[model samples]
Target: MNGKEALTPREFLRIADFFATNGYRLGPKIGEGTYSKVRIAERSNNGEFLAVKIIDKRIAKKSYVTKFLPRELEIAVLVKHPNVICTYEILHQGELVYIIMDYAERGDLLQLIQTCGGVSEKEAKRMFKEMAEAVKYLHNLGIAHRDLKCENILIMRDKRIALSDFGFSRLYLDQQHGDVTSKTYCGSRAYASPELLRGAPYDPRTNDVWSLGVILFIMICGKMPFDDRNLKLMLKKQMSEGVTVPETVKTQVSSECVRLVYQILDPNTDSRPGVVDILQSDWLN
Candidate 1:
């Protein structure tokens, strides 16, 4: 453990006291962030275990508390899908905001991928399908999971994928009633599309597709599609006919599966397939 905590021991005690009043008993620390920490909480009434993300508004940047925090709260309530993490309750007291959600005993997809060096093609197919379905559901609701990554994809007790961490999520449609152009630089650079890397205004939906492709590639190949160390070269490879997978690794996975990843990773946003196309892919079927 780093031993550095967002919440001091006293702060945790204060929050625990607050939750007790709301029929919850805070337990062990399960997760954390720069400005917040997640603890497992038990409901006093029914003994249901849930995760409470305690965000300290005092420590967090003003812009986050005023902007992203509100949108995240709104999106958490609106997003209701089997494959997505369920936010059961949201409570606030003074400078602390509490987001209580389903407690997934298992860790995230990234941890699973790293531990096993990657799963078999069949396993990848099952996991990716769930991830795609979650993204599809969010898009249908005019919500964009702008930060889709292995880390954000949680592993439930059943080992099913539950897309989580919607701090970067946004309701993307504009007044003209269409996907709006994005200039805000959000999400990890490793999972970003060519347009996002270029710092240009682009469609967030297709950008999301590119990120999904990256995750799928990592799941099957056990590594990233491009090395971000050389940004220029990575962008060059992404835009060309170069095969993303290593020659040695290519022989292990099926050509069809590789093709599907390549298609979704297309740098040309116009040609990039959406979450729906990915869900309907033959490999997934």
Candidate 2:
């Protein structure tokens, strides 16, 4: 499809006026989702290309924290990094919120794994490095990406990765660590840490490291380390037996890498290596 078909109803209306005053065309629908939709388009006047993510305004307005879309705008506006999805602009038309951002052709990491049947050792190492660096950067900025997962990690044109979706992120500016106890249980069941499962006091970094280990495990093995029909049983195994990096996976990944994964997946959050340890590992460095 051409550029016109790419623009959203509101974007089309706005662009229609601008085009009446100037010129351009919208391209084709590149991707879409339950909460939003994305498309590629070109500006007629300067031939500039752009990707737009459109969210329903009425729904956004009705969202508890996102009432009037300020929270989402805050997240989109504040987060910017080479390894983070870049939000270009936030536009409002009637009751809709449209966020314009850079488009990554490769989409999310889960799809990437599905295509390749899991990443090779070298590629997984490279991706792990990038993902760790991004996490480090966010932590330094006092941000904890509480909901990190394959679906939240997107692949860019250069094959580099970018972290997305800060809706569940927590910004901790104080140097002092907060209380370890968290009443609310968050994160995917498969990726949830032992502390989260136990409903105990938990630090963000500690839990994040566990989830990271799970991601790396999935990357190498093409499946989760803990596989059980029942969620409770699966978590019990993760807590008690620990996630076993299969023999085949161990062969593909370095011993150091496997060791590091073991270090991170330790059920005891207090004993799990912090971000620094993960970064300084031989596999990463």
Most TM-score-accurate candidate: 1
> For candidate 2, lDDT tens digit of each residue in 1-285?
122344458866774454334333545567664456676656666776666666654443254335324544676678778888888766665654567677777888899888888988889998988888888887777677767889888888899999876655666454476544444466676787877777765677677788899899889889877764677897789877887888977776789989988998998776888888898998888
Cα RMSD (angstroms) for every candidate in the order listed: 2.0, 4.4
TM-score, predicted candidate 1 vs. hidden true structure: 0.94
What C-alpha lDDT do the candidate models reach, one value each? 0.85, 0.73
Over 1-285, each residue of candidate 1 has an lDDT whose tens digit, in order, gives: 123674678977887888899999999987787678888999999998888888888888898888888999999988888999999889989988889998888889889988999989888888889888988999888888889888888998998889988888888988586657788888888898889888889888888888999999999888988888887777777778543677866788888898898799888888888888888877877
lDDT of 2: 0.73
lDDT of 1 at 86: 98
TM-score of each candidate structure, all chains considered together:
0.94, 0.82
Off by over 4 Å in 2: 1-27, 32-34, 41-49, 60-71, 174-183
Q: How many pairs in model 1 have backbone atoms within 3 A of each other, for residues 3 or more apart or on separate chains, i.e. clashes?
A: 0
